[model samples]
Target: MTVSNTRQQVKLSDAVQRIQPSGIRRFFDLASTMDNVISLGVGEPDFATPWNVREASIASLERGITSYTANAGLMELRSEISSYLKTNFGTSYSPENEVLVTVGASEGIDLALRATVNPGDEILIVEPCFVSYAPLVSLVGGVPIPVPTSIKNDFKVLSEEIEKRITNKTKGIMLSYPSNPTGAIMVKQELEEISKVIIEHDLLVISDEIYGELSYDSVHVSIPSIEGMWERTILISGFSKSYAMTGWRLGYVAGPEIYTKAMLKIHQYAMMCASTMAQYAAIEALKNGKEEMENMKVSYRQRRNYFVKALKDIGLNCHMPGGAFYAFPSITITGLTSEEFAEKLLLEEHVAVVPGNVFGSGGEGHIRCSYATSLPHLEEAIKRMDRFIKRTNG
Candidate 1:
């Protein structure tokens, strides 16, 4: 090694340069450094993983089942997932050929994009969408075309809007319902209409149904279940939200065999398999965790109602979220941008919420408040937020 005046420069892929740090993570990073911060920033569920699920993982360990699984995952787990899908959503999938187990829905998103998109292809993303989709699309050399939805309609994307955004370059659409930032979900009829547009355009759909089990008022619809849509739709879901198993990092994607096989190839090369123990635990969750999932849904529904009411009472414009655990309340009444409102609230009241603009352009006037925390924390956060708002307005 010679010491020289000129140093070799490190290089990164253009794809890496095109992406930015997640906006949601920035708020958490700042909140972590402060004391007594009540964060509704991260979307993680606050509940502990259910006892039975934990026990299953422990049992797996006790049974010496700690080896790697097949790249597509264990056959029995896949079969359970396939059965669960049929039982819960009335969708049919062949576990042996159409499902690929992934590290998380995050990995499923990346793997699907990696397998399907080529340079300059466009992926349609609805605004106020999950933070990960755009970056992942860019990473896979696909252009992210965001279609902004409105708060007036509760952030629901219309079929016409989707049709308007399609172009010759459009390759697919990314759908996230019981959406991360907005908590908006598409009912069965709504999804059927959207599916028609997708079918007409001959486009692929990557449906992120990670929060499918958390709906409050109605059933969560899967676009793939619609006649003629299953072959073109890739459904991404996981145990993270529904089972409160974020740390377990278990998820899956089910679709036509042609696409899933391609996705599995990428999964096989990039990460051999999801954690073996987690997969085994997930098998138990799929097989025996229905009551536990329902219990969590009940608690989440109560918290969602409480927080939405509190926010509205405090003069923020809020819609009662139909699914997931977030309330996307407009911060405009406070006379601040979503980011400014969030920053001031954190500094003045030690309450943390993510600015809606982090999701996309349509979220500019809103902020996302998660009710995934305990009731006590939610109450305290509301009190602090009330004081901060009154003081600022006064």
Candidate 2:
């Protein structure tokens, strides 16, 4: 039979069609196309990976240890990861069954959502949060219910807010502390309050503590370490943030074997395992990179202090970020939406930032600026931003 005159287009999956492109990437890509643009957009550390960690990976390669690791990852790295989490996060796991190394915390997210989310299941995402959480939940056929948090509470998700949103369809909640967009963090007491709600609701938790090491004033608390949460929380973290190992693409998921085993099955099919060389490097980072890691933390803390003050001094009010390297400042005084502010700043001043609304509710009228850069760069960016605001507001 002859084909019809009108050609049919390849059908796309409903999941793929429903998801929109990353709002962060749109500005990042646009900035990339330009020169002399100082980007406070991407949330990546500026520090180089510690020398020992890099040397370990190089040594591994020299020894011809380039084979694919077991689907669950190299057992040695898993044990080290287990130890690291226990010491730092106060949460323990069995390296044998409770840990699965993946490509990145990003991949860990995909695995966790796919493994747990059933069609129509509702995953409660705390908003003004990471952009990936809701979309990943949606891609797995789960409904992502946004629980909005505002600057009034320093962007912390209150227990009452969580309790009010719970329903029969609610399966679990996604939490990111030292949050990507807002740099908001919940203290142990705050998390405990929310933990009570999660326990009462008998819900699962996906705690993205990738930025745990970047906490400024207080220790980062893991949900699994809280009472009644060990059995329900899946802890996702990795070398990307703490060790400046983003390019290494190494991350691990630790939780009850029931959840991790499911993630492993998916990891086996989708990714097989994380890089062997990176796993070797991560082992070194955990064992001997603490001094360098702490040094980076000190530098970030300095940058954060300077950047927050600089933003406020320029009349863009910002909450002092408790952790991570981002500063989400309200640009409402300039009479511009978040998108307009970010676009104009990038085009007019050649300084790049991510618009807040891209991060979900409570993000409107704000912009996420990463201070994970040199102090001089951050200072200059702020000066340019101040100039732009003065000129715009006038």
Candidate 3:
């Protein structure tokens, strides 16, 4: 009687099950399974970690400094981070109370959402955004609202759009400049305008400046540093992009003390602290890696220019990205969905790009090409993409 041959399906938590898997990853998985593929799909630096930064981590290991670091990270490293922020962006944070190190900027994103979001609260997310933001908001029981930006406006999130979307349920906003898919940045005036809206709405902000050092035009402005904004903005940044330390998994959040305290509590119980060796390496990076960081930026800018030009030459309309390593080019001319374009481009030319809609709605007619690789690879990817475009158009 107990052995009725019935197989039952296991269920996932509805909260987790309802969120869609990242669209950015499918193409990445497809690209990896193919040979001789040039991947412009992932936003990662191709540069090796600077030799000195690597050496510092090695030195820490040789000295047997492998114990778990303080939950807030080493004081020395935090101090250096504080100094780097001030010197570079004119922003200040107290190492003792305002910064909490995490595994990566991704963790910081989670901790920030967890600290502030309540069920049914709405978090305004700008599109085209990083793929993680919307899901992260949903995971915290918050509604993720999209504020669509356009290529015609250089993809900057307009304050008017943000203002229009604000309702009594709105609790916060999330911004990433040197934005992921579009690589579009808001100049200080634009950010200042957006900050006005944030202030008027009395909204908290989670500002992702992970690509701060990669700005190609004007300097990257941290929203928290703007007048009246420090009280409301949570700043997220890390070593991955700036110092080519992606695998080391180090990032941090700096904000008002209360929010930092809340995030730190969640972080200690959930993650404890970031890697000890990585923290030591980051200390060295903030102290001496500026030149290396700039060199990488210079390289990326050249590739960005070359690739955007090449895409234009192929009859695809592309906006020159102001920062980060990605160029968002319109694929509407070929009359293909973003996924159709990316999948077919990979199969046809062995060149991989992320379909832009993965980022958000405004990205529907576009594809994201990362220029973080070498100039030669970018040139070749362009040639392959050009052929694919012609064949599709015909």
Per-residue accuracy of model 2 over 1-394 as CA lDDT, tens digit each: 8878997889999889989999999998999999999999978999889899999999999999999999999999999999988888788899999999999999998999999999999999999888898999999899999999988889999999999999999999999998988888988898899999999999999999999999999988887899899999988999999999999998989999999999999999988889999999999999999999999999999999999999999999999999999999999999999999999999999999999999996799999999999999998998899999999999
Clashing pairs in 3: none
Measured against the true structure, the TM-scores of the candidates, in listed sequence, are 0.98, 0.98, 0.97
Candidate 1 lDDT over residue span 1-394, tens digit each: 9779997898999889878998888788889999999998878899888889999999999999889999899999999999999988888999999988999999999999999999999999988988899999998789999988888888889999999999999999998998888899988888888888898889999999999999999998777888888889999999999999999999999999999999998899999999999998899899888899999899999999888999989989888788999999998877899899998899889999999998998899899998998999999999999998899889
lDDT of 2 at 159: 94
Query: What's the true lDDT of residue 346 in model 1?
Result: 92
2 against 3, candidate with superior lDDT = 2
Task: Name the lDDT value of residue 329 in candidate 1.
Answer: 93
Number of backbone-clashing residue pairs for each candidate, in the order shown: 0, 0, 0
